[model samples]
Target: MPSFYSKKDLFFQLFENQNCLELTQLPYFSDHSKETFTLVLEAAEQIAEKSLYPIFREMDRQEPQLVDGKIRIHPAMGTIIRKFGEDGWINAIFPYEEGGQQLPWVIHLAAGFIFQASNYSASVFPFLTTGAANLIRTFGSKELKEKFTPKMFAGKWQGTMALTEPDAGSSLSDLTTTATPASISGVYRIKGQKIYISAGDHDACENIIHLMLARIEGAPSGTKGISLFVVPKIRLDGAPNDVLTQGIYHKMGYKGAPIAHLMMGSQEECEGYLVGEAHQGLKYMFQMMNEARLGVGMNAVAIATAAFQASLAYAKERPQGRKISEKDLSKPQVPIIEHSDVKRMLLFQKSVTEGALALLIYCGILSDKIAQETSAAKKLKMEALLDLLTPIAKSYPSEMGVKSTSMAVQVLGGAGYTTDFPVEQYFRESRIHPIHEGTTGIHGLDLLGRKVWLQEGLGWKTLQQEIQHSLDQVKSIQELNDLGHSFEEIFLKFNHSAGELLFKRNLGPEKFLADATLFLEASGILCVGWMWIKQAISAQKAISSGALEQSFYLGKIETARYFMEYELVKILGLIPRFHAASYPTVTMEKDWF
Candidate 1:
């Protein structure tokens, strides 16, 4: 049977050949999202392949620059970024009421995999803009929306979320940017220096909208005192002002997008408008930050997929070694793929990239349900679940994405380790993800310190129920029966581990955070294991009946088994690493390092 990457027939069959994914059949997939996602993915692939991929190397070489007090990217990048937003590619999931396509979030993200993978650096522009726009459309007042929404939506303007001050990186409460009442109507004066703002300034659009966090007069100290403001680059009526370029950064990777140090309200008062309520800025801004976090996860998935595909293709064609079975030394070497170790590496990349893709895509669909379900109770429940899952979605992909991309370069041998190949660049580009929105440590804390215990443990219960359901389905599949049984046992062990951690809270909560990172890893694996089972089950019925081609079904079943056997089996290893008797990390102290 033939192998097909665009397995439309198989996808249709999995959703029972319906036009949209049937959430009723597969609760993980949201309804009425399949076709739209598929089509958008198709479109994204075209743009990525044609426009984005070719420019990746060039963008990395050029990087973004400050020329004569102006932020400049590769000359070609301006056109590409503009075209991206012009395609409505940037406005995929915003409300249709606000002139957006109103496509489900699932499709938006699934399509995004192609764009990011093809050209990760170039993709950050529209990605950050959408992040900024999400804040406005979600919490901005009607007048603010009216003034900003059309320009942002139509690609006439770009957007960014400016939260990090020089003093505050991950510790947002340390921010010192100031916000004072404006003489201008319905606006505030923003005076602050923002650092590491991606897409912070660019010539791609006429104006740039910065969603900045600052403190108001008489506001409480710390993060509670912060407020979000919209500060535009261009003066009103299309007048060009002496905006502070400050400086543009040269990063290790993701060179196409400018990471800028912007100084607003440095001159004649920079105009701004309040988003949401005063002192409620941090709370409201989370809506955008959470979405961006999920987006970072999805972006990692796409880039990882691209790296895997490239390396796999390179391995198959780049002959370098003899097959294991070959006895003749005089004969020419076979492809590197014939080597068991190389195959193992490629398969590792494949399994991780695929599993990450499935999990991220599933989260996107859940986002759709959070909005469109019309059930107030169901919406609240799903929102909480989403909140719990977002950190996992973002950090897991980052943690794994770096590994997968690294393997891709290893597959290329020496050539991949250099700038001559894109894999190395992919490796560098993916590094920013885990650190940007939030550090992995921060995300782990959010999962363990907050999400796990929130709402009287409701989110954990919901996830547990879903895991049980997946495990139950796995028991029925003959091929997965043994692995599924093993997963069930390991999962139970995790539940016990959680209980022990809580019941034995003698150590400081900070010490307890030792294995918390591992805890996140374990839960992520289980989540993917559950998703793998779903994919396998869907593949099974079709492969058995000969409705689907044999190779595709077999691959799904094999990969699913791979996750169950290797990934699910990992829970055993993690428990030991997590609950160590002595932490080499803590006990040794800083002097050891």
Candidate 2:
């Protein structure tokens, strides 16, 4: 089988570009070293190659089905989940007292990327459990944690974030799910339906645990009223909990994982255990949502990286037409990689996947730093920066990954259009990321309408300082001075445009957010540009120090150059739209459509 991802690129992003090992210096992570991290990655790779990749196509071809009220998935997922638990992956990043390794989040994300690239459909099962168990460990009562996490960590039960109701897809305040106090303390009767729930009702485990959102009876209206619950498919007494799987969604791609539509209290017997304080569910769920947002970004990069690998392999081995200058019909055709256009396409994929990977890993490192920092002031600053970048990290990779996977298909020509290749499936899977965790448009609004001005613009100022520091470092390197200068110019222009937009906040909500998506696109491009500049600086230093793989380092610099010239320049087109006086998209009548 062809390689699905680049280990060299992953290691380069983790160690050289991001300096992930520096995280080990933190007292919280002092038990670990670079060797331990490498071993974790190797273990993930072994499982992915042996259990997941070989069944990638089979799972897609034969999707989950709702049979007699139970959703049955591929038989292999049960074993996969068990192995993940047996190997401690489910609790790897938790505290040692919690039966975890005190692993840094960055290392965990790196190991996850390998599984994601190998088989994204199968990969969701265990990670969802991790996120759910984490929510319990963080906010649930001692009884809740002790009861749920042990089985969850053991892979005996599945976990899911049950938030999206039919009416409350993105608007959580409008959720209709209701929770009433039961006869027992700390337990409520949950009576609502949830839809589009991933890993909601798979037969891979003995039980399904949903970290769900519901509104308490007589609670305040809007977001303040929301509450979270731990609702299970099977009660602790070994009896059914009255949670029903109404139906399973058949999707375009990512068919291997089931998306469930559920009914909670058809018999009025569903029981839910409260998590944390009442009416504070949204606050707690944001923790999981933000983490999943980054995971979604990595998911995009992983799928695109896999597609790029498939296309690269095809391009190198599949001989095609000769160069345009070749007039001799007798000359043997050359591999498609020899063509300039194909090379351009490949470079675009590389630049996007690698650049986005760098940004996500940077965010992960920030998370680790925030968790371990001793100084209150520095921790607050890191939190602000992370808040600022969360939406960008989540949306950029998702939106661009679709285009990157499409380019992979284009490189393979007609072969990519057929099922004979994985690129097409990758193309389908890529579409979900933009819509998952929150749609791109939603994040666009959140970025411009909320995140930019968060903590009185602390995140905004901190990000500028961070970028400037990188630029300052790059400028000292003679070989990268010009590229650094180019990025600085665009960076200033982007800030100017963003400043103008922020000033428009006084105009009204609609006017301010009318072009928020455009602002998001420009910001994404600029942020990726910053990541590439950092990468270029790393590559230049490695070359100067006599790195062994000369071509790999050289390619990093070239990809950075290509991004600055081609991708970063696109921001210019968006700057003018920010200055426009008229607002058509906001004012246009709906009937006109």
Candidate 3:
């Protein structure tokens, strides 16, 4: 079997580049060390190799089916979920009191990267459960937790976040899902439909727990009235709830996990236990949503990484046309890897997958820091920074992952388009990410309209300071000074463009956000550029210290250079568009099309 991911690079990003071991210093994670982290990652790899990757293609081929009103998925999923739970993966990052190891979120995310790279579809089940269960642990009542979490944590019950409805996909405020009070104090009758719910309905587990969002029957309209509920497919009394698996979506990719369309209370029998307080559903769901956003970004990176690996392996073994300079007819064709274009494509994939992984890991580190931080002021600062980067972290990888995986397909030429290679599946899988968690456009608005202005722009300022700190560190290193200067210059230009656009907020929401997606793209590039600079600085320091892996360090430096020269420079082109006074897109008539 071909390698789907690089453990060496993952360790480099975690330990050498990001210094994730520093997280162990916090009391919350003090019990853990590098050795334990390594063991966890090794175990994840063993599981991925043994259970996940071997069936990667098989899962995709045999997509889930709605059989006799029950959604049936790959047979291995039950065993996989049980294995994840048995090995403490679902609750791995929770506090010790919660029956967890107090592991760092960064390490857990890193392990998730390995599994996702091995098999994107199979990997979704556990993480979705993790996110849903986390919501319950964080906001659910003690009784709710007691009744639901043990089974979820034990893999006997699957957890899902059911938010999207047919009429309200991204517009949460418009969701019409209704909840009525039940005879019981904390229970409500959930009467609404939820669509496109991932892992929403699966027979692999005995029961399905839905972290559902709904509005109370007489509550105020819009988002203010929204509330959260814990709706189960089966009642606690072992009787069926009215949560029906109405249908199943046959997706273009990510076929292993069923995307369920469900109807609740059709028989007026669905019982929903209220989670936390009423009228704060959106607020509580954000915790899971934001985490899911980062997970979506990582999912994109992992699939692209898998595709890159497949293409890379094929390039090394497949003999193709001779170099342009070779004229002799008797000369044997060289491996495709020898070609310049192929190298460029491979470099693009590497720069994207590695750079994006670094950014996601950095976000994970921020999450860890925020969790352990005691000082209210300091925690707010970190929160501001993390909030600002969330959309960028989610959007950049998702948007660029498409191009990166396409490059993988291009590198393999005709073989990449066929089922003979895995790149095509990866290509299909990569398309879902930009739409998942939240669409790229939704995140763009979140980034520019909301997150950028968070805490009166403290997040933006924090990001600038962080980037400049990296710049300061690299400026003194002779090997990296030029690249450092290049990034600084481009970043300044990007920042100036952003400032000019922000100044236009007074013009109206439409005018300001008409090009928000462009702003998002530029910000994503600049952020990834900063990540690359950080990596280059680490690689340069290691090289200066005479690290044994000379080639690995050198490759890191070259990939960083490629990103700075090629990918990062594209931000310069977007800078001018930001300054455009009259926006045609905003003013264009609806009937013009």
Each model's RMSD to truth, in Å?
3.3, 0.8, 0.9
Error of 2 at 105 (Å): 0.5
Q: Write model 3 residue lDDT over 1-593, tens digit each, in one string.
A: 57999999999999999999999899988899999999999999999999999999999999999999999999999999988888899999998889999999999999999999999999999889899899999999899999999889888899999999999999988999899998889899989899999999998999999999999988988888999999999999999999999999999899998999999999998999989999999999999999989999999999999988888999999999999999997999999999988899999999999999999999999999999899999999999999999999998999889999999989888888999889999998999999998999998899999999989999999999999999999898999988988898998888888889999899999999999999999999999999999999999989999999899999999999999999999998888888988899977899998
Q: Count the backbone clashes (under 3 Å) in each candidate.
A: 2, 0, 0
Each prediction's TM-score versus the true structure: 0.92, 0.99, 0.99
lDDT of model number 2: 0.94
In the range 58-128, model 1's lDDT, one tens digit per residue, is: 98888777888778777776687678778887776765566667666666665666677778887777777
- Among all windows of ten consecutive residues in candidate 3, which has the lowest summed lDDT? 490-499
- Model 2, residue 560: C-alpha shift (Å): 0.5
Q: How close is candidate 1 to the true structure, as a TM-score?
A: 0.92
Off by over 4 Å in 3: none
CA lDDT of every candidate: 0.76, 0.94, 0.93
